[model samples]
Every structure is written in structure tokens, then in C-alpha cells.
Target: MTGSFAVTKHAEGAGVIRLAVRGEIDDEVSDALAGIVANAAAQPGVTALVIDLEKVRFLAAAGISALLEGRAATLQHGCSYQVVNARGVVHGVLATTGLLSLFQTTIRRTAAHR
Candidate 1:
């Protein structure tokens, strides 16, 4: 509701880590996001990292910074990274900042067709 945040890791493909982020991402969780992404990227057999923000309701500037930092870390580690499911305000912020290219952006579609 107010300031809740959570990150859950899910395995993807042969070497990928998908982090599903939920709740508001403000100053408090921004640092945590960076740390989590860095650690996950550094883990063995992790060649790709995905930050799914479909459930994220509110994303502040700090959160944007974290995503940028996380992308840098992934590139530094030679690991592919992408942030998906960014819609509404999150999409606007990322688009306005020209980060859509940095992190291959994609929306999470509901299960209806295909």
C-alpha cells in the first residue's frame, strides 16, 4: 500500500535471473535494488538479468538511478540485462530519460491471446 517493497528471484533459461519487483520504489528500496542486481549478476551461471517491474506502482528518481546503476553493473560483468513490464508512470519516466534503449524494454501481457 504505502511503502511496501519486495523482490523475488526466479530462474530463467540456462543462465538468467529474473527479479520480480512489487510495490513502491523510493529512496529506501533503490539501493537495495542495485545491490540485489549486482549480486545476482555476479552469481555463477548467470549470463542474463531481468528486472520485472510490472507490479511496481510508484517509481521515484532514486529507483530510476538504481536501474541505471544495475544496467551498468550488468554490462561491466558482461551479463545481458533488461527491465520489462514498465507501464504508465514508469514507462514515461524511462522513456523521458532515454533509457528505453539501455534496457530492452517490454510490457508484460496478460494471458488472453497467445
Candidate 2:
């Protein structure tokens, strides 16, 4: 089934890029998400990348891999990376994959309630 997703970027001053993502994050959306993060990581002055996943409903392995790849790309460019607002199944997947501690995560209520 086709999934829906959206990515909105907010430049936080000279070195931070905050990307807010919503909806399903699966194989269909991983490539696009990776592209966004990669482009931001490649920016000359960007030193930090924050991926906000509070509104995400599902995250497949492809999506997790994309995040890991983005983290590596950011680090290579001397930038820090963080994934926030992961909860429920998303959180479980990350944790089960032993990536929970690898990325910064913030547990928050789902967007539907807010």
C-alpha cells in the first residue's frame, strides 16, 4: 500500500537543521527522507541534524537504515544527529535493533492527541 509522509526543514541558526517528519515512514519514503537529510548534512555551515518523528505512525527497517545512514553522513561532516519523538512501535523497533541508544530519542505523546 502507498504510504504518506512529509518532511519540513527548519534551519536553526548557523549550524542546526531541524527536520520535522510526519506520517508513515517505510521503504517507499526512506529514499526521499535520506535525500533531505543528506542534502542538509552537506550544507557548509550545518553542524547538527534533528529529526522530529513525533507524528510518525510507522517506521520500517528501511527508514531506520536511512536514519543510521544520515547519522553517519552528518558525523562525517562534523555534525551531530538526533532523532526525537519516537514512541510505541517505532520506539520498540529501534530498541530491538539495539539502536535506541545510538540516536538521541525523546518520548512524547502521539500527534493525534495534540
> TM-scores across all candidates?
0.90, 0.86
lDDT for each residue of candidate 2 in 7-81, tens digit (9 for 90 to 100): 988886868788889888888988888888988999988889989887788899899988988888888888999
TM-score for predicted model 2 compared with the true structure? 0.86
Model 2 lDDT at residue 31: 86
Which number leads on TM-score? 1
Pairs with backbone N, CA or C atoms under 3 Å apart (clashes), candidate 1:
none
lDDT of 1 by residue, 58-79 (tens): 8899999999899999888989
Error in Å for residue 31 of model 1: 0.5
State the local distance difference test value for candidate 1. Answer: 0.87
Clash totals for all candidate models: 0, 0
lDDT of every model, 2 decimals: 0.87, 0.84
